[model samples]
Target chain A: MFHTTFYIRRLHSICGLAVLGMVLFEHIFTNSMAIFGPAALNGALEMMELIPKPIFLGLELGGIAIPLLFHAIYGVYIALQANNNASNYGYCRNRNFTLQRWTAWYLVIFLIWHVGYLRLYTKGITGTPISYELLQNYFQNPVVVVLYVLGMFAAIFHFCNGITTFCMTWGITKGPRSQNVVSVLSMGLCAILCLITLTFMGSYLI
Target chain B: MAEKKVRFVIERQDSPESQPYTQEFDVDYRPGLNVVAALMEIQKNPVTVDGKKVAPVVWECNCLEKVCGACMMVINGRARQACCALVDEIEQPIHLAPARTFPVIRDLLIDRTRMFEALKKIQGWVELDGSWDVKDAPIQNPYTAQTAYEISHCMTCGCCLEACPNVGPQSDFIGPAPTVQAYLFNLHPLGKFDKPKRLNALMEKGGITSCGNSQNCVEVCPKFIKLTTYLAQLNRDVNIQALKNIFNN
Candidate 1:
């Protein structure tokens, strides 16, 4: 059989949009509850627990872990192998190709720290309370705030640019004009995503 | 006939370590002159347009035809083999330079080892050995045979790579030609035995996914091979193969 990475690439793409994209938006919305005060933020967590443990765990592993692993591993493979010369060549397509890989690398570090701190170490694994106070305390650390902002930027860039790439790779956008439209849309989406993240982060910081 | 003057502005690098500079040469043009013929005329005289003595411009050629893929140079910003680049077909004061995608050996010559290495990675050739006989060849469908033959017409002249935005010193992406070879050989009956091997190679870092699908390759191929078609097909096939591996494992 051919290398599994080929399949992984497509799956990485699909999962990025279908699974991660959906989850990412929901996550920000939940975080956005910070504006309503800590109880509302904590309430969102309580509401999330309404889903049964077995099912939620299954969703976490099947929907999140597997897909994320494939995406990250295959992405690293791409980053290691990518030859970035688009700056010299002045090809927009090549520039996007190289940029996507670089963003993926940024996501590697950011995702690890984000997921590890929030999902694993913070709430789910250790059973710490997911509350507005927790976020307040978390934001007290200047270094943590910097990391979170940087992480948000990286994730948003990867997710947005990822949609653009998905459109091209799947032949959804063939013409240069169509590609330009998609790129513009993704950029717009990036701004929106970052705004939501900042809103959530800002509520805690201020 | 009055001496016909042909001008060449060639990009020259003195040695591997030296910086490059351009020098213009005016040579006596002959009838039916191609880029190579004009280069040859300049070679004997080794004199610049201003009559300054200089080393002869350097380049590589084998078949003196499009087949061998040597003599590939940038003529007017387009990558093509110089042997068949008729002087009359293009505009005057033709600018000649080494293919930008590869390291230049000297003036108008580049090391095409990248393409060869890519071929090796993809196992671009049939593995039939001394142990196999001609009678053991597999029967091929006529339509499939024809298409495969077309893909086989790639001269590896680096024109496609030169035109390709994804291929360069910074990229491990193998470009389009070798990927087509993988798809071509995999269609063969005997070659099916080695399909897994070829596909596995393509699944590597510089393999198929690296292609940005810019579609520039088809336009620049000397043979007009249907590279994107094979790439799309293989993209599907490689996915199926991955599913197969996962299920079996």
Candidate 2:
């Protein structure tokens, strides 16, 4: 019954905001604890580790993995189909239009490397819970640090810009004035998140 | 000083299948002359600035006003009504081209069948069972009626489509004009009976979901229709329709 593109598009948006967005928020916030030094960061990870393995696995699989997969895959299809003429029609919204798609493409690669290297490969190989020590060691690599910096910015922009469009898509912001307000608010949120993330990364470099 | 002249670089196509090329012309300038008038002058002489005699540029217009959307073309890189595009207001070497969103029939003329087809798909009319006159008709809220009146100004021009990145050779989007029309018709008391039908059509591919909401449509719309607002309203309506379909089925 939900076979139409209309439903599918809405479902994609729902997955992005309801599922992926929440997870990203939690991830950034938790990781930001690293700015307080290893003890605070380890404390946060230890708290997450308190959840039972089965429940954690279920949450990861259903809440994060499946939805992220759908969002990325469907997102790629949408990106490929887009005919971006932002070069010709270089209006502010049009530039954002092109940037949204480009950022999606970047996130696909960044996510694969970020999640794969950390979540799957590291966890699989080390056979240890992710802790401050692990991230500290991981961020020791200058290349990884650069990658993470760029990746974080891309993710933040995608999510924050996404909030504006999501509002429009679901009929939240109806007019140009309301849309401008929402865009400003969303960008402010993006900036704050970026600052927190940068502080988190700074803790590693030192 | 020499006689005032308006320079024009008009794009011409021999046939629908032929390649389009630009031809420059000099139209003797007149005060308050519009782009359509400039084209008319060029048609009379049918000669290029380089002194080559050629077939008159083919274009379409009626009413010579902005009300009829027939005279719409790209004037100086913007899709607008040539009738209202005054010569003095626009930059010289006035660039004229067919609104490329629709297939170019020839020269500055384009085939707007796709827009009409989209209108037909949306059932963009108040359907009445019979011509029998009725004494009592439901009154509409003045506010709602005003909004509907604003949306009703759309003349099926392809300017919105021309400016839209989504509606092109690469995409299947029905574009903003028809979607706004769907909202316009659905606002009517008599049109409410077919709301389900219209919403279902919008639920399909190349429908409301196809809109990327870059908002170029609203920016280019000559009628100043609140296209994005109506689109958002329809987005809400169609989602409600989908939910109804789910439980009712």
Candidate 3:
């Protein structure tokens, strides 16, 4: 049997890559629809609206929310217990390790509030049809806009750096050269993600 | 000419149970003085900056050139051997302390028995089973020999463990050096025969997965062992071992 700490860690990595990662990928692609136009974004939303309510609720709870909640809570546990001696040691990955923990925190806070506010307004509470108007109104508030930008930054950073870590930890990147490839790829991924996410965000303001 | 003076702010504890406090010493700085030499100078004097005669600072050392690995301690906020830490290279009022990761014995020493335990748990040695030296010892490939030579440089100084974040009294991360040791033994032909056993040990609690790959170990290792690289290899090997277990069993 795998060691308990090791097992939990592997599970954490697995849940991170397989479940949460897919959700982020899907959400990003879907949100990138805004780059086309508001109508395009709304049309994309309509297709999603066709999924039966119970099934949709189930997907949100089972597929995204629950797994995400577990990943976040467990991440918090690990981050809290983990220490970083990077200041003394001055290693590059040690800095990344420390930054990963910080980004984990930022992502958790932003996700909770973002998900709650958006989900409740659109589905759980208001049942309002999401449109450019809704986003515009949302972004009108300076605080909301700031939170969204910060949240987007945290999520992208957490995801991108996480990809690099995932590769090494799982042995997918066995050596330095291969890991370097993964690192560069993840950085590119981060760049694309930030551009699209922020581009759409700016469109909402415009 | 005025005596070139060096000041030290070192953490000390009288006994394992006693509280730790800071002690200061001012010494006549000779050119090319290292922390170990400075400690020796202090040991001879046993006097404080405040002019109080105190007990000599206790520390461990041998092969003062940094090879023996006995002289490791945190010098100036970083963990390294006091032996090679030349005085002129670093700042004055250098802060010295026992490695915080391990429990202190007295002044600058801590018990590194857990490291030995980790090595034992991982079965670091190649399995001979009383066949100390086989006449037909397997000839090695040049590449494998090169990798093995790199791993053989580890001196068990406990720097990797001390600088690591996850390692402490509460956590069971066996540190990085032993993981490289596992890979080293796994590469030997006879050692390769028992590879599954060693990999299985790695699968045990406090094994390879505990490493988050912050890589402070590689940075701080005086031997300059590519610890994370071996860890990366060991990670791959462990997975293959798991797969083998699944199919063979």
Candidate 4:
């Protein structure tokens, strides 16, 4: 049988990398209001609206939706398979494996509910069909803003952890050379993601 | 100050089919006493805590450091070297038993031959035809040297096997220690010459595919060796081997 770790970890990496790139683009375009002007941001938003709703939703569901579900499900299978539980290596030991799996699940559930309420339902956050104006109207709620902020950070942490683990899983990182690199990158990714997230959330808190 | 008494509850087994029982003893405490040292004290004077004469406790030790992994046993429910487990650090009435992952040979001794057998199955070595001259070997990078050095630190202590859920009496899984060793040698630039053979061995029954990825082996390894990481790599390596076999056929 094909080893699931190879396929599942690679799947997570491909999906996560694509979503991260897309989210980064969206963030830059939406927040261009302060950089250029309200008119510039509106122009960018109008261009985004030209894309068909079904196509956009399909991309969101396929890219952000399906891969995550498979990643989390297979991630759990791998965790349960490896657990002997005879000895305790402190809570931190092997916890990242399980934590990453559960966090992926949390992200999926959070994303589905938030997306449906924010953009899909008629009486949802936008309170109208998903037009550029509706999208703008939805971001006005502080709760939605906070949830999205946290969700984004959660995604960042989840992706970073997945990427680092993926390297090890694929044997890209091995022995002491790659071992040291994995350690540095694992911590580095977490720190950078945390910083970027704090920067984004800090604006709202202030 | 007068010496204080310490209690020990050690489990004894005559053979694989024999029943096990606990025997308690009291030893005179010293400033730098360890479990092995205390066992030595018991060996010198074989007597129970209840003032009855008995056979001396039997155990194994060497190197007195953790390097050899020969003195490995269950101390207070933790698998580690008895030579380094300080008496003071352990809770009172320190319990000692042979590691359950392997067949017990006696009181605190286990047959680690199974690990060696598994190593043999994986052919955990680099095969050389002796055709290449000794001095004509290719130079390796410093990075490769460093990682090989870490992987070389493995003492085959069977800690990873004990932690692995797939390795048991009922299961035929070869466990993680041997597989990691297989990867270690196979990744050697010279060793890569035998990569196909190694990969084939890993792809066989009780090979790399048997690993469930619970990552318990990584957690319990005292050397902090990356067992799961290597196992995953072996997965990919075996996949390539499978394709090559199909294409060749």
Candidate 5:
């Protein structure tokens, strides 16, 4: 019989790679909003806005619905499978697998609450334009700012760590030299992403 | 710098046909010295504890770095290259033995011919057909170049095979390293030309499906190569190749 860990790792890789590509696409598109001015972004949001009465019920049942449910269920499965409880900080061991498990769990919970608050209810209450101004205002709140910072940090760390493991999983970094290079590069990339998020939030919000 | 005395209990055998025994020795160590260095000190003076003279212990070392993979032995029960194992970092009374996974040649030396044979069976190399000029070989996509650069770092260290449960005496499973190497070649622009041949090799009994996904191979690989990722991708590639073959037939 196949070990459950293999299935989980493989699934996690699939999810991580696809999600990473999606996030990257969104980031580029969102940043491009600057070119057309804040009104353009808000206008686009206004154009695509969903109705709140019956559609709200549909979204609640379907929007953050099926995909989120399936993702979370499988996310938990992967998190549980990747965990190595026996290690308990043993000497002479590689900590990659254990670290991957811990990071996955942390990100899944954080993402759920983030999406719940940001998109689900706030969109209805604020009824505000999804412009740069609105983004600045949302981030200006201390709690929002701190939460965004922490969430972005968690996401970036989890991302780089996953990418490192992904390299290993795909046999890309085949040995010590390649691993050392990828380790250094992954950390550098994560730092760059963190800097971009923090600088933007810092300059615009504060 | 002062010389520190290091103690070691090494498993020794005179030849492939001989019986084995534990031999202890105390050797003067220098800063940044390794298990192999201490063994060399013992070689200079083949004396054992309790005042007994003996034959010099035989092992292997080349490059004095971790690249050659010739210096792999069990240090404190962990399979690693002795050249990179610093004496200061290791716990005292460091026990040394030839890696039990391979046939013991003598004291601290093992025959790693099994790994070489596995590599051979997979034809783990770019076919050197002389048809194309060097300039005309298809330029690699930058992404492909980046991925290939990572996969090319394998040093043929047998740690992955040693840790793999399926790659044992009773089984013909090719283990993780060789399989991953095959995929590396398969990804090349020109290397893709031989995709069918390599996929056929993978479809054989010891091919990609034989991997049990115990993941022990990835855990113990000292080089930190991602064994499972290539294995999974290879599994997908082989399945696709089989479908294509069916249509062609």
Candidate 6:
């Protein structure tokens, strides 16, 4: 039971870092195109849509879906088993420890809504490719805009914090000094990503 | 001038199954007095601040110095050795409690048997036989030996476990001390022969994967062991071992 668990845990980290992490960067960059207005955003989406349907399907399934489902499901199991004593311990890292798990829980809900509503349901019912207009229509709901803002923050925090842990998990940053440096860097990246994504969201409201 | 006094608030429990309660005491403030010395003053009197006689505060200590790792407790919300927690350094009205990660045997005495069991689980020693005269052991590289020596300083003090969020009544993590011990022994040339066994042990549930890398263990360790570094190295080792296991079978 545990032998496979060890591998699964490592794989979970790898999925978060190598797989989902890359997808998040791509996602944020693509969304950031909205800052240039609908035309630029749609043009970027059109470019992506040009990929062969089979290849796109394969990438979505193998690169995103399978790893993501495994990461999410196993992540929930790991989070549940955690004994978060940050309330008692109250160290900076301990607080981050608690936040990481909490963000994970939030992301599970947010992802289901974000993907199910935006990706599958919207496209399935409308019989149209996802476009800036479609996203605009979706975000017109005040509740969705609020939910997306919170969801974006959770995803960004989880991914950036996941990077620091991935480094430690792989022994990339072994010492306290190095780990601190990586942590500061990851936070910087998170701040930058958040700024960019928020700007993108703001474009829709205008 | 009036004599100075240091106050103490100790969490007390009568037995393993009993509820815990706090009792207050005042000890004569002596310069250079550590927490253990203050506790000793309380032990001698066995009286509460309410002016009622009570049972003596129970605790464990072998070496009065920090090396024995006995007498570890939560001092002012931090897990550390009471023998080294000087009264002058800490704020007055010191709060003392057993290291809650382990079962409290009494007032501040905790049963560290789980740590011992973890050490055993990791097989934290080299195998030896007395049937024949042993040959010369391999001389270790000085740098490697230094690293090993640093990790070897862990006294099985429950501080790491106490500070670890992953180690508790509800969690299964074996805590950081034993993980470092496994790495320490694996660093030995002879111990390397049994490296697969140690790696297998760490591969089990509540092994290395259970480490959330919150790093409170490194912060609280009195020995200042580079616990995170060793754990990271062990993480790499186990991954490599897992790959080897996959291909070998």
Q: Which stretches of candidate 4 lie over 4 Å from their true place?
A: A1-46, A82-102, A108-112, A115-150, A175-178, A198-206, B6-26, B40-70, B74-78, B86-121, B125-155, B162-175, B184-194, B200-249
Return the clash pairs for model 5, or none: A168-B226, A169-B229, A170-B229
- What does chain B score (TM) in every candidate? 0.93, 0.96, 0.96, 0.91, 0.89, 0.97
| Local accuracy of candidate 4 as per-residue lDDT tens digits, B1-249 | 677999999998877779988899999988889999999999999899888888888788887878888888888877777888899888989999888779988888888999899888877876655876565556665776776777788888887787666676656678898987887887687787888877777766667766644567776677777676677678667767767876877
Please, what are the lDDT tens digits per residue for candidate 4 over residues A117-161? Answer: 755675445566434345445557888767776777666666666
TM-score of chain A of 3: 0.92
Q: Residue by residue across A1-206, what tens digits does model 3's lDDT show?
A: 64566567778888888888889888888888888888888888889999998999899998998889889998998787668766776666788789889889988888878887788756568878777667788889989888887777777877888888888888888777887798888879989898888888888877
Q: Best by DockQ, which number?
A: 6
CAPRI grade of model 1 = incorrect
Q: For residues B1-249, what per-residue lDDT tens digits would candidate 5 score against the true structure?
A: 665678889899888879989988888868888878888889999888766999988888898877778888878866688888899999989888887667889888888887777777767777766776555667777877876777787777777666554565555677788888888888887777787777778767656655544466666676777676667678767657666766767
Candidate 1 lDDT over residue span A1-206, tens digit each: 34455556677679888888877778778988887878889899889889999999899899888888877886676566545555434555556666677777777888888788888997777889667777788889989898888777777777888787777666466455676798899999899889888888888866
User: In candidate 6 chain A, where is summed lDDT lowest over 10 consecutive residues?
Assistant: A118-127
Q: lDDT per residue, candidate 1, B11-108, as tens digits?
A: 99876667889999987766788999888888888999888999999998889878989888888777888999998888889899888688887888
* CAPRI tier of model 6: medium
Looking at candidate 1 chain A, the ten consecutive residues that score lowest on lDDT are A81-90
Question: TM-score for every candidate vs. truth?
Answer: 0.65, 0.91, 0.93, 0.64, 0.54, 0.93
Query: By summed lDDT, which 10 consecutive residues of candidate 2 chain A come out lowest?
Result: A80-89
Ten contiguous residues minimizing lDDT sum, candidate 4 chain A = A84-93
Q: How good is the docking of model 3, by CAPRI class?
A: medium
Clash-forming residue pairs, model 3: none
Higher-scoring candidate on TM-score, 2 or 5: 2
Please give the DockQ score of every candidate, comma-separated: 0.18, 0.59, 0.64, 0.13, 0.03, 0.65
Query: A28 in model 1: Cα distance from truth in Å?
Result: 9.0
Candidates in descending DockQ order: 6, 3, 2, 1, 4, 5
Chain A TM-scores, all candidates?
0.90, 0.95, 0.92, 0.64, 0.68, 0.96
* lDDT, candidate 3, B1-249, per-residue tens: 788789999999988889999999998888888999999999999999999999999999999987889999999888899999999999888899999788789999888888899999889997766736556777876878988888898999999888888788757889998877999888897888878889899988778988887878878899999887788888888778777877897
Candidate 2: regions farther than 4 A off: A1-3, A125-143, B130-140
